[model samples]
Target: MGTMFYGDDSTALHFEDRALAHLKVVIATKLRRGESFTISWVHGPGEQRGRSTVWISPSIPLRFVFDDPEPTTLNPRYLDQLATSANSSGGIQLIDEDPVP
Candidate 1:
């Protein structure tokens, strides 16, 4: 599992390393362009019953920590889906990766 630390809060959001890598790319791109948006995700096991959303901005402190030393290969299709959601009014929604054939 990977950890994403957002803002000044000590609480950390955990994701799979592969997912975090892709999220980092899309988030970095948006933040680089000075865009602020919200990210939503469903809680996993041993967590809250529902979902959570947070506002992301260039000013906020964000960090992504992965368990693996090597980088995960990026999936264009997954990135596209994430980017599309990032641009939406509802904002980015973290979801499971599409199944590979």
Candidate 2:
């Protein structure tokens, strides 16, 4: 699993490594262009099992961490979907996709 650390404090969101990798790209692109949006996700299997959403902006500190050192080659189709969501009023919603072969 990978963790996305948001803000200056302990607001960290976790996702499967692959999904988070794709999300990181979409998020960085939006923030780089000074866009603010909301991101929502379904919670994982645990005490946090539910849905959570957050408002993301360039002013906040965001960090993306991958568990493995080797980089993941992202799927272009998934990237397009993610970017579409990021550009939407609903903002970025992470949908986990298998690696493109």
Off by over 4 Å in 2: 98-101
Q: Pairing residues by index, what is the TM-score of model 2?
A: 0.91
In the range 49-78, model 1's lDDT, one tens digit per residue, is 999999998998999889999998898999
Clashing pairs in 1: none
Report backbone clashes per prediction: 0, 0
How well is each residue in 56-78 modelled by candidate 2, as lDDT tens digits? Answer: 98999998888988889888999
Error of 1 at 3 (Å): 0.7
User: lDDT of each structure?
Assistant: 0.92, 0.87
Instruction: Specify the highest-lDDT model's number.
Output: 1
